[model samples]
Target chain A: MPQPLRYLQIFATFARNSLIRDMTFRANFLIEFISSLSWVFMNLGFYILIFHYTPSLGRDTGWGKYEFFVFTGTALMINSLAGMLFMTNADNFGELIRRGGLDFVLVKPVDTQFLVSLQRVDWSSSGNFLVGLGLAVYSLRCLGVWPSPVTIVLYVFYLLCGVVILYSLMFLLAATAVWLGRNETLFDFWFYIVSFGRYPMEIYEGRFGRPFRWFFTFIIPVLVAINVPSRFLVQSIRPQSLEEWLLPLYTIAATVIVFAVCRAVFQLALHSYRSASS
Target chain B: MAAIEIRGLSKTYRVTRKKEGLVATLRALFRPEYEYVHAVRSIDLTIESGEFVAFLGPNGAGKTTTLKLLSGIITPTSGEARVLGHIPWRRENAYRRRFALVMGQKNQLWWDLPAAESFHLHQQIYGIPPDQFTRVRDELTEMLGVRQLLHRPVRELSLGERMKMELVAALLHSPQVLFLDEPTIGLDVVAQYTIQQFLREYQARTGTTVILTSHYMKDVVVLCRRVVVIFDGQIIYDGSLTNLVDHLGDYKIITIRFSDGQVPTDLSRFGKIILREPPRVRLRVARNEATEVIRAVLARYIAEDVSVEDPPLEELIAALFASARNSRLSQERGNSAVPEDTTHSANH
Candidate 1:
């Protein structure tokens, strides 16, 4: 078998093993799944109550009730994908470093980054992802917008781009654990940054909001993650000008660049690692 | 060819110094002080293929650090080493696939998963064929007497049982070189004996080169023919185990039993009285003077039985470390008048 195919096979094995491990604690898994879905439902309910007073998020931004739901759904999908794939592993990376558990990982013949990032799979997070996708489809129907096959394909592609961006960002934060010894606030910081990406980018148009929007859009590019994918779903909300079309292209480009940079940073961190002993 | 070779291998670490109190903690956040700790000093040694060598040292004497350097878990600050002609720190996949390192305190097995699952993971990581994997796995588990616990979660196993499983998992790849850092640590007497017996047999059968570090002298005495004693990050002694006892252990214990159940008051004239019981007394006699001391004792007192034996390896090693430490302290104090005895003992 080829090298890449062998890695995929190993990943499948890890997923299966993780499933078995999770199944051993059936009650805990169920509680986590239900709690995560409840959070998503509460967020949806909060937005629905807010839309009752205001017809749209912005006076002329066209982010009415259903359009905003699409954006919220896109945010949920991206966050859930990231939470399933790398959240738990990233959260535990510091403990592994401090306790010298990484010694075993380093000695293995497989790629250390691949093994650490994908070793654990949380099946509970998949529940939120499925609900998010359902909301996206439901909202699109409520708006009476039947997107063409091409538009749906583009939306899915951009959704994947959002997940890649979030994964790279969280991975970079986790890699800091190697240098800092313990980054206990990584999840809190990540949540704070990601919460900004939950709503439409046009909402940040005030004096402080303009700079915040510009910074997050160009520097971190979290705004483009949900905005481009959600906008592509509705005809009226889609990019009208050629410059607007560049947003999706820019999201792809930023994802590639950020992923490459994060991978390099992780390698550098490993090189500088001194095993836990003196 | 030598299975392992080293040239002035050294590892220095920068350790941050933290002072107590809130003020110091706050100040450290801005500027921290660091001290250089030479965990492994420049030392050189070599071991031939299929050699079973014991690495003996006191706590914090750099035994585990040296093993870590050899296993490529941490890079050295200077110097070089090669195992089977491959630079260890380079950590090539082909090299890693041929060697294994097991640390007693640190576990490689997944806590929530069964040991068998971890064994399968190792199979994939090492790229072992299915048939060979099963064969090696069964053989190792059988030898370790852990075949029944293969499917049980690792967190539920007893320490000894878990350690057996760890050994089995490590050997599943059939690694050519094994670096065991305190492999029998924290095990009961029976468990330690079991592991030692299995290791002895396994090394004999496979001709695998093994370097083991242990505080348990029994592990060394039972399995290793050659011993390397390290002190203060340097090789202090390297030779056969018998030679080690002869070189460092200059005294033997002589136990005497009185026929009439009477204690001798002046037995100190024979040798150093180490112990005394109702009808039995023990004396520490110099190795060269044992025969004369026994002769004098026999002539002076009517003894029913007598036995002469070397001091336990544990005691001998502790004495050696104490002597080494004293000499180092004297040297540090610039006490030129104090003669250094450790060098002379090693030469003998």
Candidate 2:
């Protein structure tokens, strides 16, 4: 079916107005804004404390230890963008289905899936992205080097991949509403997984942690979005050969497959929805 | 030729069977028993093109279920049906684009935006050409008399106004078929009449095939000529509305008016007395017996006038269902698990 352009315009208008309405609750907005800033400060505070205790990467590793710590933290900051932006949609879709708000979408001419998943944007996430960028730039200055123009461009591409992996996995989880009904525990467990993508995969030094980061970096592909960019900007973090960049290459293919599967599962859920009886 | 063909169509829903309580819920979570409720049983029906058919039934009598099947909202458990030469449940976009379903209990209009936004949305969803979209949208608005309501938020409109706007949204694409489930429900008489009038004119102008289910007999009386009466998921009556009235020999009310405001002192000897006001009311009489009964009343009592009326449509429907219930009782009483009428409809 052709996209409903005017309807989408109206939908965006509604979403914008709703966001503005939330901003009107001055106390709540103030609370959330402060809490989110504090959250970023807390994550970095823990990192600086850890660096104070170990000075170098296991005392025998090659790169500047502080540079390594800050860069790995940059990966965490970029990955948080997924939480900051797309997570809201993934979280809301399952509830929307259970609540019959999905009926509102189905009666419309638009593809119900598109409306449900992208219906709202968390404009507040602009705060998380800015703070994260500032941290990355500060970490670069600590190394006394400027990232090449190519490195900056590669960072943006990786960020886009990060969003896709997040979107596809969330869509996959929300699609479970079709069979099991709404299960929010599955969605919360996803946020817990994002925490693992915070550091360099090498931190734990054991096979277990290696496979864990590898699962997220390749199988799920979220870690790649973060690790690839942070690895590039910090320079000594990534493998130096063209062949070692294969993981990021694998990410694009996996992103496509995840998206196709999400689309299929979401459509199946729509078909099975039994609307309320009169 | 038939525009719709339903052959041995049956639909059933599985309802979990368990006692009501948290304990039962937990127990059932592990080992649940389910009972099947046959919402619509195996039944064959055919509807020809350009026909306005009123589907009538008591609550849970499967009228809306049948309409849902015809509209492709739910797939049947068995058998097959076709609308406009397409299978509905497959939900091919082209087949979906050809028909519209208007449910009275739900609104397709966006609640916060002006109704026009939804119309434009339909324009894109159906891929309607620009010129045709404008022409049809304007024509529907004018016909439904909602030209002034285009700019108002749907939530602000009165029930009648909202319903008119809903009709405009449903018809913005000018579908060839319309399936309406209780389109006149919960509306004031004026609003109902306005909708009924608009529907009649729309059908007359476009010759669109309309299948509507309404509890209000007045709606069916004004809109549909042929009535399909379903009871217990079976099409017990299908033919002209007038014919069903005649063939369903149930009850007819007869009343007599006398110059002196007094009923005949003895009504029991004449017939069953239903109303006891000054002018007497008696139970309905069959055609053959009504003539003899009327003569006896005339000979024995003095009256200024007399009138015969068919029982209210609602009452007639209730009587049909009551009879169905009694038959089921008898079958259970006799413990007859044997199916009835297997020999009928030998062709299919």
Compute each candidate's TM-score over C-alphas. 0.94, 0.82
lDDT of 1 by residue, B88-192 (tens): 777788888989988899899989999999999888888889999999998988888989999999999999999999898889899999999899889999999
**Model 2: per-residue Cα lDDT over B1-348, one tens digit each:** 678899999987766787899999999999987777777888898888888899888888888778777766667889999989998776666677788888787776767667876776667667788899999989888877889889887878998899888888788788888888898889999999989999999999899999999999999989999998887778888888888777665556787786677777776665667777776555566566666777888887787888888877777767777887787667565554445633212111
How far in Å is the alpha carbon of B90 misplaced in model 2?
Answer: 2.0
Model 2, which residues run further than 4 Å from truth? A1-112, A120-154, A198-200, A218-221, A229-244, B21-24, B279-283, B289-305, B329-348
- Model 2: which docking level applies? acceptable
DockQ of 1: 0.63
**Candidate 1: clashing pairs of residues:** none
DockQ metric for all predictions: 0.63, 0.27
Clash count list over all predictions? 0, 1
How far in Å is the alpha carbon of A95 misplaced in model 1? 0.6
Q: Chain B TM-score of all predictions, in order?
A: 0.93, 0.90
What would the TM-score be for candidate 1 when compared with the true structure? 0.94
What is the lDDT for A67 in model 2? 68
